[model samples]
Target: MYSSHIKSVLEEKMWLFQLKYFPFYAEWMLMVLPFIWLITLPYWLPKFIVYLLEGKHLVIKMLILMTISLLTIFLIYMYVILGKPNQEKWKNVIFDQHIKRIAIKIYDATDNMIGGLVNRDVEVNRGIFYVERVPPLYWDVLKFREDKYLEFTNGSTGLVGLLSSPRAFNGIDVIGIPSAILHRRGGGSSLSQQLVKNFYGQDYFRNQTSLNKLNTLLRKYKELDEAKTFYHNLRENDGEEFKRWVAMYSPSLVSAGSVYGIESVAAMVFGKKPKDLSEFEQILLTNMYKYTHYFNGKAHENKCQKIKNGSKIDIKTYFAENPTKVEALIQDIDNWDCTDKPRVPLAFYKSMLAEDTKGQLLIGNPNSRIWDWAGTSMSILRHETEKYKIVYPNHLITEVKITIDTPKNISFKDSVNKAFQNVETKLASRLHVNLDDDAKSEKKQANIWISVVDEKGAIKYIYKRGNTHDKRRIGSISKIFEAIALGNRGDKYDYFYCNEAFQNLHNADGSMGGECQDNSQNNIYSARKVFGASKNLPMMSAFDKYVVKDNKGIHLIKNKIDDEKLQEIYESFNLSRDNNVTLKYELSFGLTNSTPYGLQKSVHKLTHLLYEKQLNYHEAHIMESLKYKIVKESKLINGGEKNSLFLKEIDSKTRKMFDKNTKIYMQTVLKSALDSKFNGTLKGFKSIDGYEPLFMKSGTTDKVVNEKKLTQSKWVAGAIKVKGKRYSLVIMVHSENGIGKKIGHHEIMKPIFKEIVEALNR
Candidate 1:
């Protein structure tokens, strides 16, 4: 019965272990099995029995049980402390209360500082709960006033308010002082020491004995003799100390402004004194203003002079001589009256002197010219005469000649008519106005005359006109002729010719006779020699050799002639004792062939050659390569229709490859060409012949035709067209000089070429 009861009790204890720790034992069987075995011997014996045991087996069992029990206790304690086993309910209650308190404080502070209501306020009597609400006020309002601060408060669980208040008490007021001062003061120094350091240096109060002596001397004599003596001694004893004293006591001697405690010294140095308090303030203020304004104005004047002179004048000497000019000019500009009839007043003139003369004095009329009103036209003229001495001196009044005299008690209509008449006959040409024929009749009827000369004996170029149709036509025709004369003419052709011709037509002596002829040569000679050599032969070829080659291509290479040799040939040609017959022949054939038109045509050909090369190269690389035999057979069979048909087929196939490759290459080539030739070095060459060389490389590509598609598209169509058609070629030119207008030659010739090409293809 006793054994049975003991077995029953062991069974009940085993069942209790299995129920309480069975899952953990199963999961950590390897970890728990040894510990269970270690404690099993003690578990079988009573605690008192185990303690009484003294044999080796009993002692070992007791030791093992103690080790296992201690280990188990340690693990359980760790689980309780670190893992918070069985503590979630209590922890949640405590943490919720803490969070609620913090949230309430934050909300209250935000409402107190910022004038706004918070959203989703929580009532936190015991614990915390999450609630969604609007965001806090934005920070941008800080820009309005720095002193403002926002406070937030939670009145209940779902409500909040933001109030504005001073930032000082809420803990952010000490941020107004400059960062430099704050940083130095934060380094643990007394306020008095900081003040001294700001006015003087760190060593000013370091010596107590010296400071005491200075204090006693200042008290007795109202002057710090000890301090003065110390500084004097430092001047003799230490070179660096002497420099510091000089810098502090006499800054104006070595620099330009007063140093700390040096205002009296500065006055003494300048040998000036104030009679009264106001006088003292005024003198100091005036001196300060003068130094700042004078030096800065002088610098600005030097800069302006440098810009005006560009690479010609030295700025340092220029400013030294005329420091006050820039300030005067700026003052004048600021005071200018833009509301006057001409929108220019006395101040405008003063500013104009600086701008126009660039500091130089004006002795004659500066405002009379077109440049005073138009900057672009002025720039154009300036560029043209950059090497010449053209001067606009000062403003001058002039009397102009009119076509009709002023009538007595003139009616408005009559006055208008008289003005229009003057414009048509005299003023219109100069002013660039156009009048109709009916306006001329009004001029004759009104008896109006406009003076073309000014009070200063200067000539006026512009005129007013009457309502007569003829007078109106005179102005209109003048503008039309001006436009036509300026179009597409070569640079070598003299503008003086057109100007001279216009003057002569008006029965006036030509203004260009001697000055224009100084640079001019016989048109025929220039055309035959210069144009022929530059375009027909190699650019480096001699005139004589090129002339010889003109009759035939053989003489050019045989002569081995160049530019140096060309000069000699030209001199020889000049010395030739040619009769009238020979002269006529040279003039007609040689000179005329080298005319501007001929040069222009030659340049056009060169452009065509370049285009051909580019197109061929692009087509060859970018097009689908067809077998030569196929193209050849197609061409042979299609004989009469070969060129057009072959080009069309090749173009279609090439267009596909254009997408895969040529699109990018074409863009690159176009941009390079535009940069290199159109917008860069070639920009100034507006004349057709001058632009010819840029396209020369393109012509060379025609000689080496390799791809069937290129041959078909470029050669077949181009060759056929060249043989049978006289296609009109168009050219475009751009210029910076503004000597002439832009020309779009292609726009004019497109229709002509279209008709010719269409007829030939049909």
Candidate 2:
């Protein structure tokens, strides 16, 4: 019979192991055990009476308590075993207490705080994640190893009682910590740090010093530091941030089958905020958190009774003492709205900020198109709730100060957002409306590219439309190239032969007025005059013979039209510097098509050249790409020796990319552009009133259709200086009805020219 009893005991212990260690809600089953202990309280009374008489009964009872006291010292361990913190019979029990207005003044004081956070423009810049609203009395009553003031210091389980344990709602790991202590246990840790860890999880913590401390005094002070921080947050955020802090701790089942935060639970229980709850209601709520419940009193009645059984204070008469507080709270339940939503004020806050941060964009799109990278998460606000991720904004397009000079007297630096919108709208609306308007217009597609460069050469603003990629011919604009090429030709040639066979344009002459009458004659003209007339035939004729070769008839290919030289030229001109643009079509010298972007970019370079500054493409870019990140990685470089060596190697290559000769040659080409006395090609552009054109060039491409040569495309591109500020412009018009010389200026291109001019002249 003794062996049988031993076998039975072994079986019981194994069953207990499964219930304790396995992932089950066994806390519900074991909650009944606490009630058994309570039932044995009467048994203890008889033993106590016997001990007073014989003393033997006292010895037996003391011995039993000693045997089990080592394993189960804290009241916390008793409830935790059942997979929860409360006995099951009484799921949630409000102690039969003499509930009184103990903190009526405190409750009244916080009411304004609750309202200001929601209704007024309080400083709610920071979001409250979670904090518990534990009154001082609750902390006082925790039965553990007492400190100097008889306050508990978590004697049994301690802070590490629960490790990073996963839980069932809102993805918050239960952390084995009683959710109450995590939030309300407040202070030395910064919100910036805890926010990071709470939202991002414990894995985000590089140094879990908050959890690592073993010394009692040090840990207590550490907790006090966190407490102070949270208290300050309550005052600063008007308690809204702190309320949210309380919410995340124990995401309780406040309604049927749904979990919500402390704020929502308060609104659910008393139709008010935690700050507005009466002392009686506050105590009831705090006790209920020991084992989270679904707002219904029936589901948690056993735990409620268990709470009453363990209380040291007298509460039976206390319940009768304040019927009004209880009655009013129950009346609130009659009109209560049960839902899992943030307090109305916090919900309003997230909504207001949604629109302002949507324009924030991620930088890597390359197209420079705006996208709401923050999305619905409002990641800028949310991301900081954890550690400050260093790479976030850098990963977004970085913001650097850029200066802008606009025709409208607008501050481009301060108002670039408006510029981005207006420029895009004007271009998009023009293209959208005009492309569908005239049946006579066969312009397949069109685009415009405008960019402003600051004094420091930073790109302040850039605007683009369709056809920015494809290479469309820039006809007479090639004159600008010929002029620069000739000026930089490295050979001294006074005159170039203009043959009569060169019929550049229909019924038009590109010859010097000193001699030429018709295309049947041969003439010699100055190289500069060839450029001003956009005398395509003469320019092309002079190009291969005189421009490319010296007066001795030897080819002057100093900077050969090879890969490196051409790339250098393109880079200097800002023409198709990126691989996104192509330059497969060789320079025609006004023979075939070239990109409009290429032409505009060349004019842009001329503007800089006029200012006596230039972007050194080859060397500047190479060093810029390397140097951009140096400021960030300054520590790794140690000293200036390595940086000096890197700079020394690039010094010689960058020396002459924009030397005096190149600048002089470019400036001469720019000056010669407006010298249209010979051809009068650009004189017809009176479209920009009161604004004198500094220099100009026009281009057109023709196609023979039904034996009639109709103009396929027309372009007028140039630079104009107005109000001491310089601006460059490019215009392109395509029409099947003929967009040649007259139509380009009159129909499609002139209005846009006028808009730009008007803004600048204003």
Candidate 3:
């Protein structure tokens, strides 16, 4: 009875294991059965021919049945592998269109972001792998090092070998896969298979917990199909296609704590371009293919063990006996340098591989040479996709090219950095505190945020000193949206009296006021002036008259402003995850909570719309031109097919934010706000030296306690044209401790504007 019970328990455990891994076992079984038949094919061929000559009807029937069975199994396998993975369930034909909006926004915001893989100059600038430039020895060594059993020209996955040999889906050596799985042995893969895995990500095949054997098999099959298709289509032309393949699929190397292209890796390791690398350096890089992370100048314990044990075996003998030690041996060397540098080729071919006792090697790991220069633009892309609940594949070959207008000697980063430094210096001077003094209370310190966008909708510069995404009271910048909405309602030029009765509560000192106020009391202002001058009383009167509609006698001011109009604008700008519905707005101006980024986008859109109207151009024309160029270029990259993977489709029906005539009118009104003759608040800031034709508006928010007002927020938001290009610059300064000391926008922020213009001119 005891023996029976023990037997039953063991049987149950085995059954559970089988049940859990059924798909895994079934996949392997299917492969192994074919492998057996493949091995016996030569023997069966002679007999099969004899049967055909003898006209054996039973043999023909058996062959038909076998073909039918195989076809059914193939169909089932295709269905399982080709079906969309659960991770990408959110993406479909409809939701894919929204991806275009995100892509365009990112393209605009990252217009000046430095470096990327998709640049045309990558081959010359970054030294990414090019067919002509790469040393032939690199390929010879790669063949010997990674996959020695077959010729590499059979395409990425070695599809020919896969069909001919008894190997796995990726053409892994029959003996290798079983050893690798059972004993944790490492194995080689075809180049196409490796590239496919790289497309999935670094850990897609490397991490077992994240992907089980069943999923790996499925993924491997899919990779085979993709690689075969891409290779056949692109290589048909027979010129630079291989280079393009490498450019697209190679994984990035880690350098300076970030993943970068081949040039960065080369700089980190040898301080040289790939073409300039010595033979020893080439060998070292080839060796790094096995273990990328192990090459970061860290001592590998396992590799070092063999060195410590003083093994004197030659390279061929050692490689043959201990294949696993190949990577360990290479990594444990002095700084990854070859000790026998002068005789590198001779030693590599003839003698034993050795390590250095005195460590001072410059050798580091080399990853597959793929460029990743998108920089901050990638963050915007991520935010938008996440907001829309879409899982965009990371490996899509998205391109972003910017036509920088700055001087060649001065990079975008350097110019933007200098501009911000000058602004920080100005802010420090005003606060009378050291800019580096972190101990100062946050409330007492002034925070300035600047965002610049060009007429092409590209965000050329953004202040990186503070969190631009932190939602705060946007103050009168909200009036841009209000003005556009009211313009749509044909009330843009409607005049309203700046009533003192509707003003904000004044401070005892009579310096500033809170919430709602129009200092120009009793003056009549149009909606254009209300926006350009940022007159709160006139804006409120216009908002109450034009926007706040009476329905069922229930107050709908909050819903109309916050829920309907503001939400639409926010969504149009694609402000990631901004909850406009919950925000409470008592009047038209100064209380709309928004990020500096969002405010900048709103101002940029308004100014660009005005500029386009003034130039007699339409936004739809620009969108269509951009869309056509992108789609055409994308199709070229993907071998003359509109790759479904690319987010190239954009909505053609673009709604004009404001009427063309209204925009033209607003442009003049905005310019008037910067004119001294109009008694504009920012008239003093009009003379920006070389960058003239300045149009601006100023906004201020104050808090009153015990009838004492404290200035909390101040803004100077507008556009300036330089060299026939419109650039909208939005500057916001906030203080936690009330800045009761009065300082006009002209006096406080004009210097920053001048510095920015100087940087641009430089």
Q: Rate the local accuracy (lDDT) of all candidates.
A: 0.23, 0.38, 0.45
Count of clashes, each model: 87, 47, 5
- Model 2 lDDT, residue 219, Cα: 40
- Candidate 1 global TM-score: 0.14
What TM-score would every model get versus the actual structure? 0.14, 0.40, 0.51
Question: What TM-score quantifies how close candidate 2 is to the native fold?
Answer: 0.40
Flag regions of model 1 displaced more than 4 Å. 1-558, 562-762
Clashes of 1: 87
Worst 10 residues of 2 by lDDT: 96-105
lDDT of 3 at 1: 97
Per-residue lDDT of model 1, residues 72-111, tens digit only: 6544322211111122422354223222221111101111
Which one wins on lDDT? 3
- Residue pairs of candidate 3 with colliding backbone atoms: 115-373, 116-373, 335-361, 335-363, 504-516
Query: TM-score rank, highest first?
Result: 3, 2, 1
lDDT-best of 1 and 3:
3
| Model 2 lDDT per residue over 161-235, tens place | 223222211111233234445577433232322332333232324354455544433443333323323323232
